[model samples]
Target: MVKIYYYKEDDSPMTAPHDSGEPVAAEELEKLGVFYKYIDSQASVDNLATERQYKNRDYITLDGATFPGGEEALNAKLDVFFNEHIHEDEEIRYIIDGTGYFDVRDNNDRWVRTLVEKYDLLILPAGIYHRFTLTDDKFVKALRLFKDEPKWVALNRIDGNTESNEFRKEYFASLSS
Candidate 1:
């Protein structure tokens, strides 16, 4: 069950926000310019992982257990990689196991914390401001999708004002309405 919650950047309630796992569908996410799908079962997740093919893209998996320091090392990697940034390539990921939240800004520039769990496949388009964090589970195995050998690069814009954020610019048409 993938759920999304909107919050102001300044609204620091000082608590975790993975509240309700309300049923959210792929079509609903598309309205916010995101593509999402939930696998039928663990069998499907395994098949997808083994086949390593999606639509037309290739996917590669990253496992926390295989890292040098295991969970700690993997958390460090995720922390470094996750940030308020936009990418030139679509950032697609499948949660093979564990859970995390991907906070993506909406048309109003408010953070939408999306809880993605096992068997969840998410496709975030290029040039979207987003970040991620693991839950208390603190461990995740994910398969990353790529059009080519992935050259991961992100333009971090965490310090920008509302007017200057690219999210505000592109979504103005919808926001203005």
Candidate 2:
């Protein structure tokens, strides 16, 4: 079962639990326009993508720089992933295996950490400020789905450039309603 809790602010590593352990209901997440679903892990990826109207898809295995550039590259990637950012399109990720955390900002601008496991599918509305990190195992394999050509861009919240974005404006408006 996927679960969410309030995130604890601390100087611990990104992979640290940093969990307040205070559970948050699924409806609370949905109220922020963050949708979730669960598809059998054995289900066909192509079928799922088609049904969801996803135009492009790929797999990413995050297991300590096991791909290409080695540990240094993996470190760089983690830095990017852990940075609070927003996307121009809905960010969809399906956990194929392992576990990870997706920390999303709530209406009150607090962190809500959700632990995602196998078969879990998260559909984060476009422009939602969020970030991700792996659990202590430091491993997770996920299917990344996109509506069009993959947008691998992340407008980091620290830069203050995401405020005027159209998708972001629309997302915030939906929250008020």
Which numbered prediction scores highest in lDDT against the true structure? 2
Q: Can you write out model 1's per-residue Cα lDDT over 1-177, one digit (the tens) per residue?
A: 567766434543212564544444445557777877798575765566456453334444345667678866876767765667777666788877777778777766666778888888887876677887776656677777665666677667755554454544564444345
Can you write out model 2's per-residue Cα lDDT over 50-151, one digit (the tens) per residue? 887999888999987485687667667888999999999989989999988999999889999999999999999999999998887878999999999998
TM-score of each predicted structure versus truth: 0.67, 0.93
Measured over all alpha carbons after superposition, the RMSD of each candidate to the real structure, in angstroms, is 5.4, 1.6
Give, for candidate 2, the lowest lDDT window spanning 10 residues: 40-49
lDDT of 1 at 21: 40
